[model samples]
Target chain A: MMLNLAPNIADPDDFYAELVNSQRNLDEEQALRMNARLILLLANHIGDRTVLTEAIARARAAG
Target chain B: MTNHIYPKFGYLRSKEQADGVVKRHPIVVIGAGPIGLTAALDFAARGQPVVVLDDNDTVSIGSRAVCYAKRPLEIWDRLDCASPMVDRGVSWKVGKVFFHDQLSYQFDLLPESDHQWPAMINLQQYHLEEILVAKCRANPLIDLRWKHRLISLKQPADHATLAVETPDGIFTMEAEWVIACDGANSDTRKMVGAEFTGQFFQDRFLIADVAMKADFPTERWFWFDPPFHPGQSVLLHRQADNIWRIDFQLGWEADPDAERQPERVIPRIRAMLGEDAQFSLEWVSIYQFACRRIDNFRQGRVLFAGDAAHQVSPFGARGANTGVQDIDNLAWKLAMVLRGEAPEALLDSYHEERAYAADDNILNSTRATDFITPKTKVSRYFRDAVLELAQHHGFARPLVNSGRLSVPTPYATSALNTPDEDFAIGEMRPGTNAADAPISVAGKPSWFLHCLGDGFTVVTFGKATDKTGIAIGPLAAKIIRVGRDIEDPSGLLAARYGASPGTTYLFRPDQYVAARWSGFDETKIIEAMLRATGQDSARHPAGQKELAA
Candidate 1:
């Protein structure tokens, strides 16, 4: 299966703003913990191995 | 009074010249460091004559390269030097990482108990060199010349001629092959006009060895921005002979000379220890990090190993461990070529395999250095964020890279590997280093690695097999039937190797998996043997395409 290259999330600005807002007012440590938790939760939600592999490849390529 | 004494090795006279001409040797190693001595001893064990030339007669001065990983220890075990090292060195696998006087996380590298050696040992490099040098001296085939320096080298197609300068006079000697392990500032590399290219991190670290009697547990203790030294990282390791190695991260602008002074260094030590804690300074040096390697490890008849071929920061303990591995990979190939079992083209695989390992080391080291000493404000911000999160969250703990400890690099995509076939059970795939597990030989406890001699070995899980049809050219091959001749009491051999009854494996001299099959197939085994020795082109196993799909 190919990666979902198309825009999946609607209102990209709203999502970006929400991400920044979640980290807002939190200390450096708290912000880091929040991001880590978010990553873990999303990863658990998307537990498909093939999709994870594709996403990892895309991220590495972009990096 | 400190009991650490630098052992002085007696120099041996150069072999007498025949009719006013220097005699040629089969192999010449240019340095007496751990890497050079390891190569010489390995070659000697393989029944190849070797000559080792060094400018100094003494072991390494400081406690340099203090960490010995498991793979190198296993290689040393094959050479019969691992026992002394494990006996003398401080063996530990648990590491505790702290942030600002609070324990952030702790890790156990090897939690399983089936392996013969621990994850790593903390021993001074001099002690290891002393052991290796003694072994080389005991071997009749190894000629070690101390105080002999290489002045120039000329490779004339068939052989390489090296001009050496001794205390008495200069002389010239010829060799079928030359291995340059002369260290970072290698003269042989200069003589060959090879370029070592890489970036140097703009950071300095102070290494202090102190002799103290303390009750601290024998474990690696690392601190990032402790109360004693704010905004810096500190690494503490307990070595043999009541000596403790402490490394403090000094910023790029710190004065190396000032930091090395006893007056300046004592305060830092006192801060870590209480004011009344007693300790004597042993050795101090300042170092900078550089991740660089030569483009090619082999240049015609002369090959480079150890620090001469590549250099990485000491963060991951990759410097000496990887260097020892270089010798491990090259020794068998060189011995095979010298014995005419394989063609000269086989030597190219050395360059291919070790250069890949060097790149792997450099990549890990670079990432660790970048994480530890972040280059920009944004990077530092994220680094501190991750560090802070690591204190509480388990998921963030893996993101913390104080230093990823060194592990053996698998040559998964190597040209010599016959890729994995139908059997896929464990991580022990083709092109991977062999995993050591506890087993029983004739009802006696033994290690599976010990059963693999210094030649291509065919290991079958059960029942002895006569495969006279399999031909590996002029190279020797041994067949080991585990269940029939040997017993796996713990069943670790089968578990770790992913073997079952009638399972078969082809292992190279360096204990790397060359191929595997569910049952003995003479034609496929012969093809794998030829490819592993670089006699035939690398062909992907028929099952590989299916597995990839």
Candidate 2:
């Protein structure tokens, strides 16, 4: 029913490294496209629209 | 296992030539493929006489349209052919997708269901045609003629005339109504001057049916850049009779004829299945992906169904499945019109609803084709990124679109549906296909669909009373009371259908929910039935304030 925004990844640093390494050889445009795709994939994974809207507002506020 | 031998239905001479007079028929269906034959059988079962015309005398040549989806299977079940097809075909739902030899994700199409049919079945089109042809031959109302091709068509003011070319000579015939179930290259379509316009993907695929003894499970296996075939996608499915359908994506420029040769194809199969795998090539064909449909399916007295009306890529198994649904939608309406029970305007809804379905199928097919064969570098990048992320991330799994396996498109915004007023209770809403639930009929377990016969059906959760009257124009609707007449011991009829004690649901002839209410009101039920049959154009009398209690 509600969103769980807690840290759930087993090894956060290892996942961050893996995600960065996956985009190692991509150019600027490709990297941007990959980021957009990642955002979409994650958004779809967090299927609840309410949580997605909250996450979007929080990220925008931080920026 | 023995190879399927195509049965030949001997050619019958037209009675028009023997009698030297043209006799008009109620319905004349062109093309004896799966669509045409199914329409003829459906018409005959509804007490309408039909004459089927086909150019060929035998069934389909290769295993064309091998995947039969559930919606079409449900329609076929009403015509008394789904059980035989299911008994012979391989029923499957689990599909495994791999990215560069690494398994990415797996999906179950129908995770939970007590429906009468499976989500998908891998059966050869010819096997289905054989069953339909046999059924048509047994029916006294269906006059099937082989080697009788429609060379020309003329639709005058009242009726349509067709020029047929037979083995002996050409003959002319007249019909009250004409249905074109012809294949993609339709002579009827050309004669009517209707254009099929859409996009054609710049990719070719080689489909080879190989007969082999293997232990592969009956599931769809798809691979992107496997070790055996690099830089292209491959699909493998296990059909009946130990035949395996293997498709390898060939680039647009690949020579179709050269690639079909055994010297060229055997090596590819040998690479995929170890070099020593014993197999004999059964059938091989090359095809380009294209998603196209006509502007309209109905033109005056002549109607188009199946591939003649629309076509989609084979990715989602939508071509034949949608065609069968077209028949299920059009048959009852056409019958009612021919009997003068409903107005001819009912035929227009067939065009409105099926054209909507065609657009939906084409959209899904185009998206699948683009995902499989990305046109631009950016597209490929996103596709690859999705695949890469799907391997580890749960969120990315939904982005993998090998093919969005075909499901019945709900007619959510059709003119026939009576909008829900209070709340949407169940998944079976108006304009949606009635979901099948288990129940007991006379103390024996049966399906709810079995109780809802071919005509317009009204089902009530409790006992039927004087208030539960349902009439569609001149046709008297069949009413079924679940708790009183039919026993529902499992309570699934109430649970799945979202029914209360006095809830009533009106279903169209095709078993689509036309309207539902908390309690049966005869006036409201009759109005809904008339609106569903395109009779009362009074625009769904505004509010439901009168039924608050």
Candidate 3:
């Protein structure tokens, strides 16, 4: 069972890969991880603790 | 009458035939290179009449530059040209570094940027120019003059008079402001009498574009101490025209006429290639680089931009990319000046902001250049040692990445910023590791969205409000209150910007946080903005001071 972010795209990794792994040099897996780090940092800057938790949880679940 | 038959690209307006003999535009740009074209695109998109002039009749040949940074691509996206550039260009995500043909390590630009739209694209300079020229040509308001050269210019009290040499004769056209985007060896800078000084390389290197048949990795292959060729190492890059850009870093003692014989050059390349590697030469160039910068960006109405302002070695391809960013910064400010939304004094920030960027690029490129061709044996050994450690330690890899490449820059020390609680905020230059710093937004084009209360970001933590009436400097700017709550913030933005009970941030149009205030003495915040924008100070007038026409 998967809690889809959107319809039809069951594997979140596909969209995540497009968003996070579309770039090369920093491999797709690495890009997803880096994007996660960036998201956390930005969420911290925004002072959004809840979003940060959700983001991290989502990232971990996807991985 | 001297007759020069020319093919017209629509925006090429001959001074001989115009509604008016000379019309003063809001912004007058010199040179139609990448920087100038981007400026024109930005300013015109914002409903500004833009004029671009170039001395050359056609686009520049050869792969002069292909590397564009994330920020520059976002600027292109704003111009609606990023899609074409992205589509036409190849995404070189990871680069393979080989020491003596043995793979040492691979580094990727993707993870660094988090797979943003502004991914590193290997499109040629011709592609960039083609898109820019086409965009400019379509704009009726943008008068792009090809083959028209700016011989000399005069900046008087109100306007600038450019003595442009056209096919028929010298034509005089007055402009409100002039932005010079001439290449590194800029002639427009000379007329303004601005001095550019920095590092000049002694060794002249050869870059030959060969259409190689071999199917090497699409990524950049940097061979350090190629066993076959001890003295000269090969740097290969795939260009758009199915040609490979090969740079043979010959030692400083080589003669200038090395490329005169392709037979001699072909064999040096043949050693590295497969037996069936067939290729033909597209273009070969000999260049000695200079890591130099101008003293100032603005001289009255005439502003120097791009290579005219500064030139760094092409180690990281920061030369064209940085220069293009200068235009992006200046274009909006210039549009404001013309539209009368902001005062002419607002233009002064162009010098202040980009001069710092120029200084930063020079330092970055110089370090990279030095790393590639280590002048001293000690430095050479140290760089090689780092490469060696890079094999064993993950910590060492980032150290090499930071050596000579475009990193996001933070505006920490900028006069625009004030002392925030986080002193670390003051160090973000455009292309430094500071750029690696996280802004509040995720999966967004902006490095940082700056969740300030929607006024000029005054970074001073306390009391920026009380000094609101104080004159900061030439850029007379006033602050507005969007009334944001830092501590008890509600919304994704409030959480991201840390809009807590007392946290605050000021954001500029480019989305850079101007200043973050933690409830400090408001005067210092006002003082900083005044000084930064050239307002709040009596040196330049605030609002409604038109050019003395």
lDDT of 2 by residue, B1-549 (tens): 226677877877877966768778889999999999989988987899999999999998778899999888888888888999999999999999999989888999988777789999998878888888888988999999999989999998989998889888888899989999998888899999998989888889999889999998889999987889988999999998898999999989999989988899999999999979999988889998678988789988889999999989888889999899999999999998998777799899999999998999999988888889989877777888888888988878988999888898888888889888647467788989888878887788888888888888888877547433455437567778877667778777788888787788889989999989888777778778778888764553432222221
RMSD of 3: 15.3
Query: What TM-score would you give candidate 2 relative to the actual structure?
Result: 0.90
Runs of candidate 2 exceeding 4 Å displacement: A1-63, B1-3, B464-469, B537-549
Q: Mind giving the per-residue lDDT tens digits that candidate 3 earns over B137-253?
A: 888878888778899898889989888877666778888888888877788888888888887887666777777566776787777778866845567788665767888777778
lDDT of 2: 0.86
Name the best candidate (by DockQ): 2
Instruction: Give fnat (model 2).
Output: 0.41
Per-residue CA lDDT of candidate 1, range B1-549, in tens?
Answer: 235788877666665532447778889999999999999989998999999999999999889899999999999999999999999999999998898877888899899987899899999988899999899989999988999999999999799998888777788899999999999999999999999999899999999889999988999999888999988899999999999999999999999999999999999999999999999988888999799999799988899999999999988899999999999999999999998777788899999999999999999999989988889865666676667767887756776778889998898789898877775757888888999988887778888999888988988877647542244447556778777666888888898888887788899999999999888876677778878888663354542233223
Model 3 regions lying over 4 Å from their true place? A1-63, B1-20, B112-115, B395-403, B421-504, B517-532, B537-549
Docking class of 2: acceptable
Pairs of colliding residues, candidate 1:
none
Tell me the whole-model lDDT of each prediction, alpha carbons only. 0.87, 0.86, 0.65
Native contacts matched by each model: 0.06, 0.41, 0.00
Residue A58 in candidate 2 has what lDDT?
85
